[model samples]
Target chain A: MQNLVDHTVEINKLLARYGVKFGIYKNQEFHEQLFPFDAIPRVITHEEYSELEKGLIQRVDALNAFLKDIYSEKKIVKDNVVPEDFIFASSGYLPQCEGIIPPKGIYSHISGIDLVQAKDKSWYILEDNLRIPSGASYPLIARELCRRAAPGTFKENNVVDNRNYHKLLKETMDYVNCGGISVIMTPGRYNAAYFEHSYLAERSGCVLAMYNDLFVEKNQLFYRDYKGENKKVGVIYRRISDEFLDPMSFNSESVIGVPNLMDVYRAGNVAIVNAPGNGIADDKGIYYFVPKMIKYYLNEEPILKNAPTYLPFYEEDRKYVLDNLEKLVIKDVAEAGGYGVVFGSDLSKEKLEDMKQLIINESRRFIAQEVIDFLDLDIMENGEPVPRKADLRAFVLSGKETKVWASGLTRFSRNPDSFVVNSSQGGGFKDTWVLSR
Target chain B: MGIISIEKANNLYWLGRYTERVFTTLRKFYRIFDSMIDFDDAEMVYSEYCQRLSIPNIYTSGQQFVDCYIFDPKNPDSLYHNMERAYDNAIVLRDELSSNVVSYIQLALDAIASAKGTAAPLFQLQQVVDYLFAFWGCVDDYVENEECRNIMKTGKYAERIDLYIRLQYHTKDIEKEFTKFVNRMKKTNMHCNLDKLAELTEIINTKKEFNTEYQEALNCLQGIVEVV
Candidate 1:
């Protein structure tokens, strides 16, 4: 472990050499910045991992069930386990995806469930990312480099190897593949997660594609080659959003979308990973009902806890949120990547009043949660160890079965005062080492 | 790896072109830079260098030429710009090239970027050449797709021959590059005008002085492979 800490600089240099970076647009110019890596491992005991594994698998299973029901039967709505307005009014709920069942009936093939440990050692679910969740590649690649830097440390510890993420991802695609080839479709190099898209494609042995490389012909999705020939694509693990997936189907002005692709998908000629309408299941407002969903769909109580969230859409919850505005963290339901998150305690008197008014008017637009004091993790800073705010994104894959990858992406905030640990918000990450014992 | 997309093929081709362009031009600038150090023959050699490459005479003095030609981000014909272009193309092709193979180009780009405004710019720029050499070697050793390799190498040898011709290399030197170019072009699935290729080869291997008819050869080489 000490050896891993000592070789942090060398590992970071290696990461830079491999061009491991994420792109961000500031002032309308795209800049690729290397994702900073912290050397320390976030160690989880074998027994604790067992509990998390059970909880994550149960959580993802319920989410997948909810998506299937929402898109087809509307059973959850009829039963009142989840409300009607939360389903229909969500921007995540695509009317275009109704009644369309993906192959294998799996919506979120790969689920990134954000979790944090409280100082009391209780784990709370922060958010769920079902639509093209990234960050697995960060820990996967970092662990490989860490092992090379400190082989003895790995030998001494019982940490589970996370290099099998690509294999698990491949199996998920293979399980859902209908016929021909598996392709990873990316928007382009300018995308924030382009490096992860390309790296996963390379590791998983899938064809990395852009919209120009793909076309829909004869009610089938095909990848075009340099020779102007087309090869049928059976499964596409697309990294682009649903709106930018098919120009004709969703956003008509999307130049990055493959035109008429949704028609092919609806025809069942190809499989789209995580399916298109998955945003509904991972919507921030939708998150409040997940534990209820687990009981409603799976007939079991949730093993993990939600962060005492309050959906402002409810009159009772809205009144509570308005009164406790200074204590709760407000999240804009529509935004992601650590954006649109406002800490009420950090707001001014005028802004706090404005927020209370806005919540009263557009109650469905936000969800409020009691801010949890995160269990800080130690990271190397200027050659000394210091604790920082961090959260883990545990990847749960629903393929032939739902399983949690032993490793998770642990992102920590560099600023001492901030609790936002997203890579886009200037957070550094560490590898989550789940002990095999 | 078995299938190549149109965008990737174009990027691989341009990546080859841009990298070879930087590697060859930077080496050429080294020779011209050494002559310019004498102070009297500065503008004359750089002027001829610019004319050979067919770029504008944008520099007013030797210092500006050395600075802008090697380091200026604004100069389109500068080594920095071409290296940046190579990076732009290479950055998007990580899956095909593999990150290990792409790292060499990254190393070269990093070298060129840090070499800017340094005390010993030429010495620092030598690492760019060394890294580019490593890039080619790593590609051959690691890349499994023969078509991808051939596509990128076609751009390499084609740009190399084009540069050799414009720089007025001897007919034998030009013929050696032409053979490698023809071999790689034939292996690629890229649609090429073989007649244009034959004419270009004839111009090089007519056992005649290539310097006399290099423009005609350059014209024939332009549309041989539609991408580059």
Candidate 2:
């Protein structure tokens, strides 16, 4: 571990050489910043990983099933297991995706399940990213560089090689491929996760395509080459948001979208990975019902536990949330990337009262969760080891079969006092090592 | 390598042009830097260099030229600006040209970024030239697509010829670069203004010295790519 720690600077330089960066808009100006990497890996024992693997696979399967049911039968909502208002009121629920099922009925081919281990040693899922979740490439490349930096350390540790993420991704794309070439469609270079979009495309051996490079003809998606050649697109791992995916179908003003893409998708001629309208399942408000969804859809007890969440839309939960306003963390259901999150403890008396009034006025817009006293991981700070808040985003790939990648991205907050560990909020990441033994 | 978009084709061509522009101009700057230390009217070399490239002589002194032309991110004609443009084009070509090959451009850009106002600016700036050479070498060796490599090289060689003729290199050197440009242009399926290439070639073939028809030569080279 010390050997790995000693090579942090060199590893970071390699990361920069490979252009491991995320862009952020600050004061209306774009600033591209490197996502700092720490050498100390978040090591998980094989037994622990085995448990996590089962939980992640189970959770992702349930999420996929819920998506299928919501768009088709709505059995859960009709049976009063999950309220109809939760599904209809969600900004993620797209009426355009109704009655049309994706190829293989897989809604989220790649699910990034964010989890944190509590002080009690039990793991709790904080959120589910059914949409375009990134950060997989960070640890994927870091593990590559780490192995090169300390080859002996890996051999000594009996760590499973996490370098096969690209292979896993390729397999997922291939599983749902209707017939032609698989392409990873990106908005453009200005997107925050452009590096990952391009990197994953390169590593997965898929054509990295932008909106202009693709077009729809005769209800089929085609990738246009400069030489006037065109190839049919089978599966598109679109990295753009759902609303901006098809200008003709969803957002008429979106210049980044392919016109009539949804028409092709509706015709069953192409597959969109992590099918559109997935926001309905991964919504923060929907997060509270996932455990119930696991039982309702899979008929199996949820292997993972949700971080004690309270949906404020409920009269009882709203009363509880309002009474305990100063002890909980309030999250706007529609917000992501650590935005629209307010910690009650960090709020002033006036601010807390203002938040309570806002919650009362718009209860459906918020879900509050109990702050889990998550265990902190050690990182080298100023040549000394110190503990920092961290969380793991375990990737669950649903192809022919759902499988959890052996490794995950473990992001840690750089600020000593902050608990937010998103790269957009200026956090560093470490490679997660799932031990073989 | 798989399917190049028209936008990507343009980016590849400009990537080639900008990288070469930086490489050749940095070598020129080094020579100018040397002359600036020993001669009084040495700063005039920048004005001459700018005039040849058709960029405005916006600097007040030799030091200001070095700062603005080499480091200022605001000046669109600066070396830093060219490197930024090179990266913008290279960023989109990661799939066409492998990441291993594209990384050298990133390294060169980083070199320039860190070299600003340093004690050893010359040493740091020289590394930028080294990285560009390495980048071209990587492109030739690692880029598996022949058409992609040719398109980029056509942009590269065309830019080099323009700079060489503008800076008044020997006729033999100009002929050598023009030959390379024509060779790459012939390999690419992309449309190039053959008239421009032929006129440039004719000018090179007929003239003993480029001093007389330098502007015409520059005009022909600039028009080589019919589409921007």
Candidate 3:
């Protein structure tokens, strides 16, 4: 541990040399900044990881079943387990993807489940990112560099190698691949997660393609080469959102989209990893019912717990939320990346009254939850250990069966007073060490 | 490996061009810097360099030229700008060239950023040249695709020839660099203007110096790549 702490600056220099950065758009200008790395690892004991492994697998499996059901039979809505308004009214819910089934009936091939451990060591799920979740490459490269910087740390500790993420990601892509080569499509190098897009493609041996390099011909996607030869693309792990995926189908002004891509995907000629319309399953308003979804789909109790969430659309919950607006954390269902989240205690009396009225006026657009007193992890700052709020984004990949990558991206707030740990919001990440023993 | 997209091919070719431009131009700047210490008209060397590259003379003096031409982020024709362009292409070609080889470009760019306003700017800038050398070495050792490497070298040799002729290098040096350029151009599937190549070859064979037809030779070299 001492050796690892001593080599933090050395590892950071290597990260910069490798260009492990993310792009951010502030004031309508693009800037590339490094996703800082902390040497104090978020270590999980084998016993704890085993439990987390089961819970994450079960939760992601239930979410997948929910996505499949929502797009097909509408069983959950008809059975009255999930409200129909929440499924159909979301901006994430796309009507264009109503009838088209993804290859292998798999909607989310990669799921990033964000969780936080409370002060008592109990873990709670904060959110589920089914569409396009990044940050796996951050820790994967960090662990590789860390092993070189402090070889004695791993030799002295029982750390599981987290480098097999690319291998597992490749297997997941290959499992649902139709026939031809796999491609990881990106908007451009200016996009936020471009480093991960190119890095994963290189590591997994998939071709990294831009929209201009791809075209739809005869309802099949083909990658065009300089020699004018076309290679069929069987599976595309696209990094763009669904609304910007096929310009002809969703957003006409989207220049980054491949024209008629949805036509090819709808024809069943190709597979799109984490298929379109997955927002129906991961909507924050629907998060209040994931426990019920676990029981409804898997016929088992949920292994993981949702951070006690409340939907204001319910009359009883609305009254309770109105009465307790000063204690709960209200989240806007339409926002992400640590935005649209406000703790009730942080608001003044007048603002709290305004929030209460906003909740009363727009009942379906908000979900309030009790603030989880999550435990803080110690990180090295100016050669001193200080506790900061942290969270784990555990990646669950579903190929033949759901499997959790033994490692996760443990992001923490660099600011000592903040709870938001998003990289865009000035957060740094640490290597998650899942023990082997 | 030969099957690359036209966009990627363009990036690879220009990546070679820009990286070589920074390298040779920096070496030339170092020589000019030494000459500036000995001569009264120190800034004349920069004006001559600007004329050679066909760019406008924007610097007021020799020291300003050294700072802006090498380190200024705003100068479009600066070495820093060319290095950034090299990185823009290299960042997307991770699969064609391994990450181990691509990282040297990143290191070189970072070296340029760190050298800004340093106490000993020459020492810091020298590290940029060293990293560029290391980048080329890593490309040779780590890049497995031969055609890709050749395409990059085609751009490299072509730019070297252009710079050499414009700076009135020896006819023998021009012939040596043009031969190397033709060796690479013959391997790629990209179309080159054979007429321009023939005219340049004739000029190298007959003319003793670039004192008469310098601009004409530069134009022929520029016409080698069909810029569609």
Q: Score the docking of each candidate (DockQ).
A: 0.82, 0.73, 0.69
Write the residue-wise lDDT of candidate 3 on A1-437 in tens digits: 89988999999989988889999999999999998899999999999999999999998899999988887798999999998999888888888988888898899899999999999999999999999999999999999999998899999999999999999999999999988889999898999999999899888888889999899999999988876778999999999998899999999999988999999999898999989889878899988989999999999999999999988999999999999989999999999999999999999999999999999999999999999998999999999999999999999999898999999999999898788999999999999999999
Off by over 4 Å in 2: none
Tens digits of lDDT, candidate 2, A77-146: 9999999999999999999999889999999999999999998888999999999989899999999899
Compare candidates 1 and 2 on DockQ and give the better one: 1
Model 3: runs farther than 4 Å from truth?
Answer: B1-3
Using lDDT as the yardstick, the better of models 1 and 3 is 1
Name every residue pair that clashes in candidate 2.
Answer: none
Lowest lDDT block of 10, candidate 1 chain B? B202-211
lDDT of 1 by residue, B1-228 (tens): 568888899999999999999999999888898988876968898999888889999999998999999888789999998988998898888888898998998899889889988899999999999999999999999888998999999999889989998998777787898898888988888889978978876776676665677778889998688752
Kindly indicate the candidate among 1 and 3 with the higher DockQ.
1
Error of 3 at A36 (Å): 1.1
| Residue A248 CA displacement from its true place in model 3, Å | 1.2
- Expressed as tens digits, the lDDT of each residue in B36-122 for candidate 2 is 898788557778878877899988998899999999999999999999999999998888888898899999999999999799799
B109 in model 3: Cα distance from truth in Å?
A: 1.5
Docking quality level of the chain pair in candidate 3: medium
lDDT of 1 by residue, A388-428 (tens): 99999999999999889999999999998999998888999
What overall lDDT, based on C-alpha atoms, would model 2 receive against the true structure? 0.91
Instruction: Give TM per candidate.
Output: 0.98, 0.98, 0.98
